[model samples]
Target: MKNIFKFWKKYSFVLLIAFITLSLFDLRFALAAVICMAAPVFSAVFKGRFWCGNLCPRGNFYDNVVAKFSRKKKVPEFLKSYLFRVLVLVLMMTVFILGIKQNWGDLYGIGLVFYRMIVITTIIGIVMSFVYNHRTWCHFCPMGTISSLVSKSRKNKHVLNVSADCVSCKICERQCSLGIIPYEYKGELLNHADCIQCGKCAVVCPKNAIGYKST
Candidate 1:
C-alpha cells in the first residue's frame, strides 16, 4: 500500500481519463456514472474506497487544495455533516427539478458543458474547503454519497485493527483521509461511513494491524 502509485494502482488515473473522455458523449457519460456506481461495490467486495481514495481526481483535488493548507485548524465536524448535507440537498434538487441542459449542439458542446460542470464543482468545493475540511465537496459528492449508502446496505465489512498486536499508535487514525478516529471503533468492522478504504491507514500501521475482507 505504501507503493500505492505503482503499476496497477495507476488504474485510478486511467479511470479519471476515461471519465473525461466519455463526457464527450452523453451516452458514455451515463455509462461512466454506472461504472462509477460499481466502485464502492468493488470496494466493499474487495477492500477499499478504491475509486475515491485512489482514483478520484476530486479527492486528490481536495487533498492538494484544502488539506495542504489547513493542517492545524480542522473544520468543525458538525458543519461538514449537517450544513454540508443541506447544501448538497439544495444543489441536487436544483439539478434534478430544473434539469439544466448544458449540452448545446455537437459532441464538442457536450464535452464543453461537462468540462464546465467539473470545473465549477471543483471550484466550489475548493472554496468551501477554505471554510470546511478536505471533504467539503464530499458532502455534496453524488458518487460518494451513493457509494457510501450502497456499501453500507451491502454490509461489506472490512477488517480493521482487530488483533492483539495493535500498538495503539494512532497512526491509522492520523493517516486516515476520511477523518475517522480509529481508536474509538471497537468492532471488527470499521463502522465509519466516511472511510474510503484507500488502504493508507493499513499501509502506514507500524504493527501491520489493519486488513479487510468481504462479508
Candidate 2:
C-alpha cells in the first residue's frame, strides 16, 4: 500500500494538468471526458484496469488531494451494493444521453452538458471522500465499474493472484483502494470485480503471496 501511494503521489500533478484542460479551457475541452472514459475501457480489455490505477487523473486526485483531509470513515454498505451501483450508473448515463440528445446540433450546447456533468460528478466524488473514506466514491464509480466489466469480458484476464502460502492476514483487503476483499478468493483470482490493478495488495502482503496472473 505504501509503495502504491508513493508511486501515484509522484505523478499526482497529472490530475491538476488534466483538470485544467477540462475546467479552464473552452467548451471543447469537455470532450476530454470521452477520452478519459475511453482510455480505461480500452486498457481493461488487455490489462484489467491498468489505466485506472496508473493513469486515471481523478483517482490520482482522490489519493493526493482528498486523502489529506478525509475523515476516513468506513464506506456506507449501501453504497457498495451492486444494485445501488447499477442504479447510479443507469441514472447518470440516462441523464448524459438525454442531455446530448437535447443538444444534438450545437457543439457548444453539447459541450456545456458534458462540462456540467464532469463538474458535478467531480464535486460529488470530492464531497464523498471528505464525508467517508478518501476512496469511498471509487468503489462504485461509473467509469471504474465499466472498466471492471470490460475486463471481465475476457477469459483468463490478468488479476491479483493469491498463492498457497497466503497467510490470510487480510492486509491486502484492508489496503485495497476499492474495498475489495482479496483474501476471500484464496488460491485463485480475486472474485471481486473492482480490483483496479493497483497492486497495493501485492505490495503490502507480508507473506509475499499476492501476484498478478492470468486466471
Candidate 3:
C-alpha cells in the first residue's frame, strides 16, 4: 500500500496528462473527469486532502511542470487567509455553475464546459507558476477548500501529528507546499484547515518526530 501510494505520488502527473490528451477525442474522458473532480469529496472524508496530495492531476501538473520553472516566491498573505480562500472557491463554483446552466441539458455542451474549465485552470497554473511557489493555486482551490473543511469536522481518526522531539527547526514548514508550520503545533495533531495530509512534514523531519496518530 505504501509503495502504491509512492508510485502514484511520483507518476500521477503522467496519468493526468494522458487523460487530458485523451479527452480531446473521447467522451469517456468526460466521465473520467467527473470522477476525478469528485474524488476529493470522498477521499477527504477518510484522509483529508489526500487526493490532492497523491492523485490530483492539477496538483501533479504543478509539481511536475510548474515547479521546475517556478520562481518560488512566498505566497501572499491574503491568498492564505480563510476569507480569501473561501471567496476564491465561491467565485470558481459560481463560474462553473453559470457555465453549466448556460449550456443546460446538452452532453456536448457539458463536455465543452469541462474542457474549457481545464484549459482555464491550466492557464491559471501557468501564471501562478511564474509568480509564486509550486502549488500556490492549491491553497485557494475550491475542491481543496471543501476537503479541508470535511477533514476538520471529523474526529477520532488517525491524522498527521507532531511529537516532543520536534526542535522547532522549521524544516517541515519549508517542506510544506501549502505553507503549514508543523513544528508550531508540536505535541498535538496538526489539524490546520489547509493541511492536505501530504506527509511532507513527516518526510522532512530530521528528528523523525512527525507521523500520523489517532486524534
Candidate 4:
C-alpha cells in the first residue's frame, strides 16, 4: 500500500501529459479534466486539499516538472490576498459555468471548452512557475480555493499538530510547496486552510515533532 502510494505520487503527472496530448486527437478526452477538477473538492470534505498535495495531476506536474525550472521564490503578496483570491474564484467559476451552459449537450463543443480551459490555464501556470514558485498558481487556483472552502465546514478534517518535542528548527518550512510553514503553527490542532496535508514536513522533522491529528 505504501509503495503504491509512492508510485502514484511519483508518476501521476503523466495523467496531465496524456490529457493534453491525446485530447488533441479526440477532444472527448477533455472530459477527463473533470476528474482533476472534482477530486480535490470531494476529498476536501474529509481532508483539506489532500488531493491537491497528493493526487492533482496539474499540481504534480508543477512540483515534479515545473519545479526544476522555477525560481522558487515566495509567491507575491497581492496574489495571495483575500480579495484577489476571491475575485479569481468568482471569475473563473463564472466563465466555466457560462461555457458549460453555452455548449449544453453538444459533446464536441463542451469538450472544446474544457480543452481551451486546460490548455490556457496550464500554459499560464507554467509561465508563472518559471517566474515565481512552482506552486505559485496554486495560491489562487479556483479549484484549490473551493477545496479550502469546503474543508472549513468539516469538523473532523485532518490537520498537522505540533508535539511538545518540537525544537522549532523550521526545517518543515522549506518542504511545503505552497509556503505553509508547519513549524510556525504551534497549536495542538493546527489546520491551516491552505495546508494540503502532504506530510512532507512530518517526514523531515528531525525531532519527530509533527503528527497527523484532527480538530
TM-score for all predictions?
A: 0.67, 0.85, 0.91, 0.94
Output the lDDT of residue 211, model 1: 62
Model 3 steric clash pairs = none
Q: Give the per-residue lDDT of model 3 (tens digit) for 1-215.
A: 98997777777878767766877887446546677678987888877777887688778778767789988788888987779989988888898899789978877677777877776777787798798888888887778888878887874255688988899999898888787899988898887767777787899899989998643
**Candidate with maximal TM-score:** 4
Leading candidate by lDDT: 4
Candidate 2 ranges beyond 4 A from true positions: 1-9, 16-22, 153-156, 213-215
Taken over the whole model, the C-alpha lDDT of each candidate is 0.58, 0.77, 0.79, 0.83
How many pairs in model 3 have backbone atoms within 3 A of each other, for residues 3 or more apart or on separate chains, i.e. clashes?
0
lDDT of 2 by residue, 34-91 (tens): 8777888787877777777767777778777778988878888899887888888999
Q: Write the per-residue lDDT of candidate 4 for residues 100-191, one digit (tens) a residue.
A: 99999987788888999989888888999888888888888888888878876674346678777777888989887788777676656557
Q: Is candidate 2 or candidate 3 better by lDDT?
A: 3
TM-score for predicted model 3 compared with the true structure: 0.91
Comparing 1 with 2 on TM-score, the higher-scoring candidate is: 2
- Compared with the true structure, model 2 gives a TM-score of 0.85
TM-score for predicted model 1 compared with the true structure = 0.67
Tell me the tens digit of each residue's lDDT in model 1 across 52-91.
Answer: 6665756765655457764424545764474666667567
Off by over 4 Å in 4: 213-215
